[model samples]
Target: MRKHWKSSAVSIAIATSLTLAGCSSGSGTNDKENVSSAAPSSQSSGGVSESGFPIVPEPIKLKMFTRIAPVNGPFKDMPVFQDYEKMTNIHVDFIEAPTDGFAEKKNLLFASNELPDAIYRSGLSPLEATRYGASGQLIPLEDLIEQYAPNLKALMEQYPEIRAGITTPEGHIYAIPGIVTLAAARTDKKWINKAWLDKLNLKVPETTDELYETLVAFRDQDPNDNGQKDELPMTARAGLSVVTMMSGSFGLDQQLGYNINIDNDQVQIWMGDERNKEMLMYLNKLYKEKLLDPELFSHKEADFLAKQGSGKTGFFFDQTNNNFLPIQDQYVGIAPPAGPHGDRLQAQTAPIARDFGAFAITDVNKYPEATMRWIDYFYSDEGSTLLRFGREGEHYVLKDGIPYYTDEYSTAENQPKITPYAGGGAPHIISDQVASYINPPQVQEAQKQLDPYMPKVKYGAPMFDEETAQRVNVLRNDMDKYYEEQSTKFIAGALGFDKWDEFQSTLKKMGLEELQQIYQEAYDKTK
Candidate 1:
């Protein structure tokens, strides 16, 4: 039997101010009260005990929504959830949206006020979370964390940066972020065809000029030995393509083309910097020489993969070489090439290493306390390990304190299905504890090559004031479109470098300064 949440249930009536209500419950039909009565009452003044996992004495169900795994299956049938339920006595109803159009579906769910009890791998932007928390759509979790989530509280204390990264400018935490610290967090890495380098008798490139020469050698020397000029010096399919990695060499870490950088402790729009102009010019030269892929701007992922698979690409960029075809053995991760200005490192991401707001509780949940407690288990060391690696003998095996994936789990073909069950590729905290145990030999080898060049930065998502945030959104849209269009033209020779001054002027006209100012203010506030 089910009952409506009682009047005494704590409600986040945010049209007014942050307030709390009392919790009172009478008898229930079952031995344990269901979610309708249990969540609201237990959420206030410590509804659930602060004890460890298997949070509730009786099993309860909570509805959750998230992006579906690449492998098609019922979310309820996921082995990870089945194990979690067995361990914690909590059942979940999962609503999975396809990755391609998840945001749209999520927004529709929100707009319709048909929210689930919780959203896993929520993909909520900081601005969206802030806006929702400020309204009553999402509840702030400070109270729950302090009173009900010892594991999460300890995590915040141990990693103060995590607290700072997730807390809104208003000093409220609206979501639980996934914290992934591992070799993979190195983020952007450049991979070169090492076999090709050997064929041409060229060393790995250490500078932008050297990289260009290497590309030229690959193009002219017939490194693939097909005797036809078919080798693509470099290729990328993502929007940033190689730009995110290359711009850093020019002393302008213009990530995703926003051009935001810290100079003299202030947010500077690096697109306005002269060094960026040189970088563009250099890229144009590569484009003119046919070293960079001619279809760099328009090529689909399958097209790029075809070239790599056919041994026609000598240089590429990705988080790992393992993602490439069988020829991946020939590719090795290389440092971003140094520019004459002497910057040669991938720009570190914001402090929250993993996707922020990966997990968030919705306002509709009456069992915020129970929900927080259940989620908190995943943040604890033991629980985090379990979620990340799965049952020891079943999914992984330990030898000399290191856990390795079982034979069934080792291959990539098995990972899509296996990892989701282990929470490997899912949105959850994968701390050093998890990484240390689960990182295979190949990953460790890649880590050694990448660690030295990965500079760590502490910028989190910018928290703009409501008015400024709206303006920045408008300006950012126009700025990104204009930047991409102009840069492509210059690289493709459709627009000459003679129009460089006009491009800079256009950026200024598009409110580049105001955009930087808004970001600067937000950055300062974070400090």
Candidate 2:
């Protein structure tokens, strides 16, 4: 889900081969020297115990397939892993692939019976995890967690919903989940061009009416000082929907593109909702008045940036810190606009509570216990932080009771920023007992912003059942195609509310009813 985009063919081939070979061989110790030499420590690196004991030894070599690009560059080795090997006596042989090709390469590897000792940052769906685990290609992690992962177990106890989210109905955990603590900051925020607001002498809009009035002023008053009515009141790129932040304002659940929650328990096609009709009607008004970007539906990322950089857009929605902050200096994150129904809701999606990046033991692994123990260390606070942030003093520093990035790691320096410490690369790993290890000030501020609207944060029911998951996946793809086409048509003024009924009928014909039922059944099961 992190938007890392890059690809290369050679890396893909190497990664594919490594994965296939790992899966095909039932013993992990076949390449003992390669695994042992990779470790940082001498303690129990790879071989069996001298006692010839039945119990597996501590510390082992693990082969991992991951999408996390090494900090120095592509194919560069990770120092943190080296340190981990030394400290825990576990060496991990990593098969790194570019994020763009990770999913495809992983799929190929799975099909070829070449699996690594573990997978980190895998793109497996819940259904895939279930299928693989059921077929014994992937081992159940629950017993491992109970026997070896004390740190992870404690965290799960504190937040039990995470267990529910990752657990299969059969009560096995196929993957270790990555936890995201900064829920508030994760919600996309509506951002407005403060420079334009200041020029027009307008305050930040809160309610929909206020927003509309301000946007109108922005359009007519030439806030950009160009002496031309070239301002676009609001806009988003063609594929990215800006309306998700606004939908909650219209008294709809936190639905976007395909997933819609009806009456708090049922999931259905969002575009088929009556409220969607109302939303489309409003969008049509914006289009008719020329307030919306005329090319919004067809605009590429480059085009979107051009519009924003050219000072033509008055408002847009995005992750405030990650997207908007990097570009414009004069912008403020605002609460979702209030709507006619007195709703001012914001959509907050759930973060994977377990390691979204997982480590799976292969049947080929000779020292399974050693591998498990090394991975178990990952669940430990110390190990997690090390993997996520690198050696602390090098990547980050503790200053006056707060953890802050060093000058070398600061974004302001234009230095090669470390990925693990930065958002989207890896979850922050810190000592579980260390209060200072909590999120940074900016993330805390973002969370505070959402506290006022937390009561309105509603979640769609879980859709994890195998059959229901497959149906949902199929419907999701179809709905995405339909929504993209229809939304473009509506935004471009090629479609209108006059065809709204027809749109709903078309959605039903496309299996919306079956999708809804599937979701409903899943929801009931969860309850």
Candidate 3:
């Protein structure tokens, strides 16, 4: 990915050199001050010229740090950045790092006092944002946003809860948030082997009773036709599968902590809830009947994938069929199986519209107006599309005014070769709407398949307060470890229901009450 950005980096460097030479030639005087003076006018709607360019005195350069996926192509010289700089008339000095190295590099940069003018997708936690904002290391964008960011301001007006969610208790927003409109497509869906269903002549299981019967048939009938009795009805990577889609079937929230709604006002821990015990009992019955995978608790993702690829498992939960079946035609996505209690639950983990991964201006920036104006352009439909898809006719083409990715840039065969195009850049630089505008046909089809199922899913709790977040983070970690350990023992028949009280005692001793209290308070604050 770094190789793909070479051209863009070279272009930026050339532009910077030309700007420097022009400055040295005395063609410009007080360039910074002049640019700064043009800032306020740009805040108004009529400040930009008909060409959609801000009426700033001269172009100003700003530094930025960002990360890209390893397969996303090279960063420094990518044509996307070059095109962005050329079009916006704002040179961006970018420090592009690979995704794996992003967190470490960002932390080092902050720790070493070598911060850039702005950070995009820095992956800083909410806690880090609060700490940095409080320390003045990061500037609150509330004033700058009001004065210079009309697009962002309008976005806030449309989603006021989002504004409140990201706003600090002191009434300042420390970071800009990524916007995602649909939340339902974010949950893990129950995928079953359609081939196996056909082999057994079984319709898709909608109820828990039907699912159990189907699993029993798969276990005994050997739907794979392998002749061996080596079939697992369902297999999951233990802790990963213990959440909402599965546990919610028993009328219990799958997620831990303050997000679990006891009533309208109360937040409680799901583990201590009686519904959880019932869920455990049901799971134990599956274990006793040999319907559950024996090695599930010990399996890694790779192990699960191996099982999936081998066609040994009948059903499992995953974010998408793409994770297990590359051939979308082969599998079926069924609604989560209903429990005995008639609860047909779905998991909702949609990306928040204003919860982080947005661009922000820094106090250290010498050209705030130029920077804000250039960034604000990204909010425009045209500008957003350009950032997301690349230059028209180069990365994409228009048909009847609907944008589509060009074959040369969108096909799997051309992906590596198309690195020079701007479509490969970080998503944080653009909006989801823009990306969807130029998405490949296959991607568009997949999204359509997933969209209708989204509304059926439910979201977890709101974000907890700082202190509560820290405590829940700690408690969840411990709780998960305990769950994993105890769950494995119970499923393997090493621990029995006779010792259920003992397990409860152990959880209480591990500070479960303290953890629950912290979450309850945070949940109240959100309300």
- Winner on TM-score between 2 and 3 is 2
TM-score winner, 1 or 2: 1
Candidate 2 off by > 4 Å: 1-59, 68-72, 224-232, 237-240, 255-258, 262-269, 287-290, 293-313, 320-329, 352-361, 367-384, 412-417, 420-446, 455-463
Off by over 4 Å in 1: 1-49, 254-258, 302-311, 348-350, 421-425, 436-439
On residues 1-527, what C-alpha lDDT tens digit does candidate 3 reach at each position? 00000000000000000000000000101111112122333323333322244334355566777665544565445555677665545666666666555556666665665667776545455556665677676778777667666665676676565565566667777766655443322445566778888998999887778988888998999887989998779877655365444765665552211225344445566665566667777777776788877776677767876776666778876644434444545566676667777765453344334235355545566655555556555555565556555668887787766556686766533443334222232223234445543333433444454454333222233344455556656766777679768866666678887888888888898888887676556445554
Candidate ranking (lDDT, best to worst): 1, 2, 3
Which window of 10 residues has the lowest lDDT sum in candidate 1?
1-10
lDDT of 1 by residue, 1-527 (tens): 00111101000101111111111111101111112111222212333444544455566778877776455456665466788777556788777676666667766766666777777765676656677777777889888778667766776776676776667667788877776555465364577888999998899999999999999998899998978888889887755556666876777653211466666556787775687778878988998999998888888876876776666788876554445646767877777778887777565332433566677777878777777767766665566656555668987787776566677866555645644533222555665556643344544565566566554453545544445656776887788779888877777789988888898899999999888887666556544
Q: lDDT for every model?
A: 0.64, 0.56, 0.55
Compute the lDDT of residue 192 as modeled in candidate 3: 77
How high a TM-score does candidate 1 get?
0.85
Question: If scored against the real structure, what TM-score would every candidate get?
Answer: 0.85, 0.79, 0.74
Clashes of 3: 11
